[model samples]
Target: MKTRKLTAADAEAYWELRLLALQDHPDAFSTSYEDAIKQEDPIGRVKGNLESPDAETYGIFKEGKIAGNATLRYETPVKLRHRADLVGVYLAPEIRGKGYGKMLITKMFQAARGRDGIEKINLAVADTNPAARHVYEQAGFKPFGVEEKALKMGDTYISEIHMTLVLEDDK
Candidate 1:
């Protein structure tokens, strides 16, 4: 597997990969497949965020196919600029056992460190996703809190775990 900075031209591939994540591994993400597929020009929307100043995407390709992706989205305004939100993380299960998820977040950490003002990386994962939580912990994130029963699906409740990795932790 290989990692690279994302470009606008990669949007179509990104969109499909996103839908795959939302569809195949709904538990690891906050967005529902129904809400995602309803958007018009999904590819364009992905491209827009990927190009923003406070936003960027990185993809991991396996055998010339997109296998995983992670996005870094910052608070869009100056007042909220001290923080950045890490979102849209997904890795295809067919290639899941390998280290792609760890690799993706490592690359994101490096990318974030290069920026002048980003102080922390924050993300929320479902409480049930131990595998992902392990990956994040290995990548230097520490649990801060949880939003109890934050998500509901068909009478099932899923708590959201909030975690953060301080930039200095990389030292």
Candidate 2:
């Protein structure tokens, strides 16, 4: 498997994988596949995001196809600029249980650390996804709080555990 930061040229593959992730695990994400598919110029938006300086999206490839991805997005507000949010984390089912998820997360950490003034990385994982939570814990993220009814699908509500990892300066 090969891992690297994704660029605007990889937008299509990333978007396709994102849709698959939303469809396969509706409870694992806050955005519904239906809602995501309805967005206008979705690919263009994704391309713009990929090209943005405030965010870095990492991808893991298996046999030259993107099998998983994660993104670290820095806060834009001046006072909040020292923090980043880890979002859009997803790995294909075929690639799970093989450490790729953690690997992808590690890449995010590296990216965050490489950026100046990024002291912490935050993420939210659905309560139903123990596997993802485990991976986050293994990567040194600690639970900060839980948001109840974070996502509603049909008549079911999914809560989310918010986590944070503070980066140690490599001085």
Candidate 3:
């Protein structure tokens, strides 16, 4: 498998895979497939965000196809410059448990560590998904808090477990 920071050229592939994530695991993400598909020029939007400052999206490829992805975004405010967020993490169900998830996260941490003033990496995982939570914890993320009923999908509500990984010492 190969991994790299996504670019405008990767917009189509990224969007296709992202849609799969939304459709396959509706409760795991905040965005609904209905909402995402309604956006105009979503490919352009994906490209724009990838090129935006203070944020980056990474993708893992298998046999020339995007199989997984994760995004990291840092705050712009001076006071919050030391923190960054990890979001939009997903792996194709067919590719799970082969170390792709961990590999993607490790890449994110490596990228964060290389950035100046980035001291912490924070992420939110659905509380009901212990497998995903285990992956984050095994990667050294500590639970800071839980947001009750963080996501509402139709009639069901899902809690989110907020986690953080301090990178100061690792720096």
Best-performing candidate as measured by lDDT:
2
Please, what are the lDDT tens digits per residue for candidate 3 over residues 29-79?
Answer: 999999999999999899899899889899999998999999999999989
Per-prediction backbone clash count? 0, 0, 0
Compared with the true structure, the alpha-carbon lDDT of candidate 3 equals 0.92
Local lDDT at 50 for model 3: 89
Local accuracy of candidate 1 as per-residue lDDT tens digits, 12-74: 998889888888877767689999989888888878877878787999999988889898887
Worst 10 residues of 3 by lDDT: 162-171
- What lDDT is obtained when candidate 2 is compared to the true structure? 0.93
lDDT scores in order: 0.86, 0.93, 0.92
Off by over 4 Å in 2: 169-171
Ranking by lDDT: 2, 3, 1
| Segments in model 3 whose C-alpha atoms lie over 4 Å from true places | 169-171
Pairs with steric clashes in candidate 3: none
TM-score of each: 0.94, 0.96, 0.97
- RMSD (Cα, Å) for all candidates, in order, is 1.3, 1.6, 1.2
